[model samples]
Target: MAGARVDPPVHGDPATLGGYELIGRLASGGMGRIYLARSAEGQLVAVKTLLAEGVVSDVERRRFAREVELAQRIDSAFTARVRDADPQAELPWMAIDYIAAPPLSELVRTAGVLPASAVQWLAAGTAEALVTLHGEGIIHRDLKPQNILLPLPGPRVIDFGISHANDLTRTSLTLGTIAFTSPEQARGEPSTEASDVYSLGATLFHLALGRPPYRADSDTLGLLAQVQRGQLDLDGLPKELTALIRPCLAVDPGRRPVPAEMLARFRQSLAGLPVSQGGRRWLPQRWTDLIGAYERHGRDLARGAGIGAGATAEGITVDQRTGMVPPPEPTRVYTQERERAERERAERERAERERAERERAERERAEKERVERERALLAQERLREREWQQELERRKAENKDRERAEEKARERAARARARQHASGPSSASAGAASGTSRPSSRPDPARTPPPAPAPSKASSAVVWLVALAVAALLVLWLATWV
Candidate 1:
């Protein structure tokens, strides 16, 4: 049946599948197609259908069956529960509990990477799922953001089609989305628990940065190459999460922390955290009130001081032309002191602001320097990688040439031997007598050849010679100056 454009296709007319009523297609993938189905008992279940043509080979069919059976065995609150399966059937299919929730990809697309609280919740939920999967010795090889469903209670990990059970070498399934694949996976290694962790790190990186860690023009290979070499920019990420994700995305799988351990650490990092721990609290009302009060108080203070400067304490008006009654000594002293304090405070504030500005400038300068350094390092790494690839290509070409030359030499040697044998046989047939060989004196051993300097050695000698000549010239100039 043709599936709808909408993700997790809506329910439709009933079509029977192994006595169960097929309602509609939920999702379609390369491995199989999922359909919303209802059983005889009227319980809704998701049925996955494997195409006959798709599983033409026995190995492919067995692999499909194993996936279904394995998925059925695993059960977790954070994971979609597999209800039943018929692996041996002509058209293999598996049924799982129907979960009603939008995938994380859709949610994030609709409402940008969720608020910090939501992100924390997402992390916690996914961590729990990982813990369950790890305990069962199962690695969800394809742990992309889309596979994670955001339900009302929490996040639920779905689509275990590419999951490996216990023995990593048992399956050769090329699992995982390109953008989220770990370095090892890119290098053609099987996905391990650490691979899942790397994927989580990639997802989190996307959540924080609003983009993947690596940006590339081409497909998976380009992203894989970037992943193999790219460094995460922690400046754009929250300082707390940066440390956690760094090890998760480490190029070496052995370096990443276990799922449970990572979860525990993340929880510990977030436990009892104040709203202002990261930065300014999001208190719009309080901010508005403070601003309003400051403006009102400043205006009132200015007006009062202005009026008091000209008016007498006894309600009598003072004249400026004639020497009028001067303002009270106490008031004048207070005003002068207040003005002086105000000026001092303003100066202090200005100095503080200047210092902050200078510090910010220094930070910008340092940041620029760091970026340049990182860019240089990345460039150097790329250059080295390119050089290594080129060297390999050259070596391969040289080996091919050497092989051809050896084959030609061998053929020529064989022809020469045959010619010599034919000539000796013909001579024997002609009754030619053998001649006695005369012993010749061996030539004197050649004189020991001088060792040639290496390129590096030659360059060094040239440099040293130039330096010595320069020193001599300087010495001559010094003597002339003297």
Candidate 2:
């Protein structure tokens, strides 16, 4: 309805909130600024971020987080739906439906006062919104016209700035806009359902007559004092609305009627009107046409621009409009942690390399031992061959000695045979003379023991056998040493 309160982003403004790209400034207030953003899926949303300065205390943060919970609990068609929020974010923020509707303030300020039938429609919708909100144990402490949106479907109550549970007596905040504020809130008392009701009455009065019920001067203190006085000035208001809206502005909180009762009263007051004859075609003709044109234009714009149409984003783009987000945070970081992880990885690789080297060294040592054993075996074989050659040589030497001894024995035997033959046959005289001459020169051979030569041969053979045995024993000892 009213054009976006669009402004260029200033220096030091975050390019994105959580993840939604902040395209334009909607409106800035004491709490924070609202931004127009498009989600990844192309839906528009109004992102409200709390002022970093105002978010100093844990007490205030808890209170804000509590209000966020209240906003989430309300799921009514008459109010803007909360899409996302993170109370523990860097700066606390929330994303709500971006209803392309003008505020009641803008509508009234532009078009003066609403007709009685149009006001009934608005009242009915607002009362229904209040009923839904109140049913969920929530009170919209700030229900001024600026917070009320006039969309095609109906009025969508937005901005749960100071909403709280009715059961809680004290709020973290103690003040509100004085003109629309209830007497209790102006007196610094706790907000209640009755307080919200009174604000609704004041909002309705302003919608009906183009001004709030009470005002002395426009100063904050003066307006607050007038609200504390609990006075109403509905001089030229329609006769049907006096009874319904008057009780809502009661001085005592108990005297104010609940939203359901007021909704019934407004319904009864609008019963006789011709516009109320229709089920939902009850809006004035000018407003109906206006709403229709607004919707058609919205559709045409959507079709033309695609999903993310609102942003004329200049710088960095971060689309978080799908409403999905990563995990809030780990019990968690960047350079230092990454470096630590890198160090750990490097250490693991080094350990792996060391283990591989150890295995390689062990294999090499085992191979060396095998080579040494092979060398030892080759040396032992060579020693056995040398010992065999020495044994053969010693056997050949013993054979040669045996052969010479045999020849000497054979010669001695030949001489004995010749003597026996002489003794037995001829040359007895020669034999006797030789014998007498040789007696002094040599000892005479014993002819009876003729096997002495054989005996010597046997001794020679025994010596050869012993020499072979010794060679074999030497070979065995050498093998053992090797």
Candidate 3:
């Protein structure tokens, strides 16, 4: 909740802490002051002196002492080993291995991300240190870009001032820079092995993206969001190491690959095996020679193309050409006049071609429009003829029905007369015995045929035909225009 406190630098007279002779101030921070001091045996060491005036409580002093003892126990080559410490002194000071290399941040700022080989070395060394620290049951509460020092052979992890062991929970408040704190630490939760993994992921993100994944106005909120939802954008990352980095940045702590496993994967990736085949593989010995050959080839091509050869001031000519640079010639009045005329002629030709293209496009668009209109007219005419035919068929059906009804009526009357005559003659015989009566003959009736309609729906038909003829004419006209 408080703003970053700017602690004034302690400018006391130079004094020795333990056996190391204090020299001068190297750097200072809220918790302590680092001095460039010499060991009694003449070895240079960086001594971090913690202010004791503020440590009034006995518990705070004991916690500070415990931190010093924990730091002194770590003896890994990948880490800066503490040589000596005097926790009970008026100003507690601890001496650590003074490395002679720039911080990882500085190296990246000056020179870009370490080349593939350098990154591999860094991973191997850092992973080794992490394994050692975690094995000692210590969580390196702060592991970020600035804490990793780049030594000649490899990188060394430093700054274990706020580190604590598995059982120690002295510092209730977050101690490290907010940008690199793991999600758990940022939320004031006790840190674990997974927390260290999260910090490592943040560190790798910086290395890969050339910036922290979470950088907002509020460092605390940004870090929390990164811990919750951040995913490394590895789209353009070199293929060789993306596989190794993706798992390290897994949001789930259990999903994150262990440091040792990551190191092995990194080694396997570098071996140019199936897992590493996607990335480029080049021998260190041949890289420089290949680059030189490429540069020379480029220079020769440039020379052939009548371009200037680029070189450096060290007398190292990238191009094989060796001669005094010549001054450019001035154009003559007649030559200028000829160039001007040629340019004008070319411009005129270009303008004519463009105008012709525009006219052709316009004509084609108009022709297409005409064709579409003709197709629409043809469709409309076909629909009209179908409707007229349906109407005529319905009228014919009605006329045929009337003719059938009239014929049926005439046949029924003739059959009734015949039946009456037969019944009178057979009446006696039919009454005497159960004899069968003579059957009546059926009448032969001719059904009248329906007459044809006086006129066809010539109006609709004629209109349809006219439309078809018109469309055909329009198509013909379009072709002629073309």
Candidate 4:
């Protein structure tokens, strides 16, 4: 299911398989149709079955069986754990852990390349998964983003369609995803653990840069030629990750770093970068919310799976609700061998862990001292920040004070200009203004002042002045009448 709803299965598709009710189709590939099935206990599963109507071929059977065996051998937390299978049935079917979070390719195609910190989380988790796969002696021939499911906890590598186990050589199926295919695989050579490393590097490059280093738009022959030559288009790749990823793309398998080494390298690159597996600091809120919803659904489904709900008097409780036969108990011989191997593995792990613990303690002591120094530096930075804030405030206060002063000075200047205009009123009352109009004298700046009346004349001249003024006023009136 890409989102919440599952697409309805095609008409010809079977309604049920091995008693699991097939509700919808998740995907259809060249090999088979993957159906969304529900167990009798209401638990969901992804069931992969072949696409044969009548007689199934022997080669197809072996290929499907090989996939089931390889998938079952892988018991890693970063992979979708195999649940059930029936290889010899009329239509071979294998069921794996049902997931809803979506493939990394889908996420990237929709949301674009992740940020550096998120890429760190992705690289670290994928390396760890590879470590587990290499430890199990399995090489995932196809390790593209499309085969990776991004859960809230981390990425889960799925679809072991082309995976091969080192110890067992099964059907020689010539299948590979071109975008992430290794050079050796392109050259028709046997893929080794290093080939998986190369594919992982390609996948990480795609995650960090939105597309693989090689051009996917090129035709098949050109693309294969590019892969064979180790030519890359690393335009958008982060410089910091170039060292971590470049070695993986080496032409020689022997030169590439092993899974454990790769994991350590990724950890070192992300040492100071804070990361979380459970949809944290690296991922944005919206993506986290979607993951959270899927996580809740997964939890509910796990509770309802019933395989681990309780124990019966005979052995572990089977889903009796489904009439199908449960997987048979392991024989005593196999169980004894498995127990002995587990004990030996545990002893070796315990010894190695003790040695690691001692080195870790020393590192912690040095880290503690370094943290103290950082704390002091952080305090100094805080003081500097406060000083900057204070400086900004002081500048703001000075600007405000200057503005107020300018306003007061402007008021005083305006008052002085008003007083001067009042003093000059008698002189300006002459008709000289009209005489000066020919030269078009510049207008004086206006001020707040009342126009002064014609100044009172001396008594001797008052009569004559009045008569002249009356004549002027009558002449002005005659012009108005005209």
Question: Which candidate number has the best lDDT?
Answer: 4
How close to the true structure is residue 363 of candidate 4, measured as C-alpha lDDT? 97
The lDDT of model 1 is 0.58
Q: Per-residue error at 257 for model 1, in Å?
A: 1.5
Give one digit per residue, the lDDT tens place, for model 4 in 1-482.
12433356677788888969886655454556676688888777878887776889998788778778877887887777778999999889987778656567666766667776677677778888888877877777767776777777888776553334443333222212566888898787888889888998888888788777785444445567778788887887888788778888888889988778867866777667655446576776655655665556555434532122131112111111111112332222211354665576588789999989989998999999999999999999999999999999999999999999999999997997677665565544453765653421223335333444455657649888889999999999999999
lDDT of 2 by residue, 1-482 (tens): 31343455679878887767776565554445677776777777778776667445676567658657877887888888888989887688888777765567666765467776667678788889999988877777767776777766788787553333443233232222466789988887887889989998888888788778863223344456678888666777887677767888999999999999878876787566665333136555555555454445444333433123253222111111111111222211111354565576589789999999999999999999999999999999999999999999999999999999999999997997778554542343555776664432222334343324445788899999999999999999999999
* Candidate 3 lDDT, 1-482, residue by residue in tens: 10011122256635777887665444443445566566766776667765456543566567667767888778987787878877777666667776644455544554455455545556666888888888887778767766776544555787653434444443332212544566666656777777777777667656655555553222333335555555334454556556656666666677877788867766765575444321123223332233344335333322322122232111111000100011221322211354665576578789999999999999999999999999999999998999989999999999899989999988996786566545554545554476645442321222223333355698779989999999999999999999
Q: Highest TM-score: give the candidate number.
A: 4
TM-score of 3: 0.51
Model 1 TM? 0.50
Please give, for residues 337-384, the per-residue lDDT of candidate 1 as tens digits.
Answer: 546655766897899999999999999999999999999999999999
Q: In candidate 1, which residue ranges exceed 4 Å CA deviation? A: 1-14, 54-60, 161-176, 216-220, 233-235, 266-482
Candidate 2 to native Cα RMSD, angstroms: 31.3
If both were scored by TM-score, which would come out higher, candidate 1 or candidate 3?
A: 3
C-alpha root-mean-square deviation, candidate 3: 26.4
lDDT of 4: 0.68
Candidate 1, residue 208: Cα displacement in angstroms equals 2.5
**Against the true structure, what is each candidate's TM-score?**
0.50, 0.54, 0.51, 0.56
Spell out the clash pairs found in candidate 1: none
TM-score, candidate 2, is 0.54
Cα RMSD (angstroms) for every candidate in the order listed? 38.5, 31.3, 26.4, 30.7
User: Model 1 — which ten-residue stretch has the worst lDDT?
Assistant: 315-324
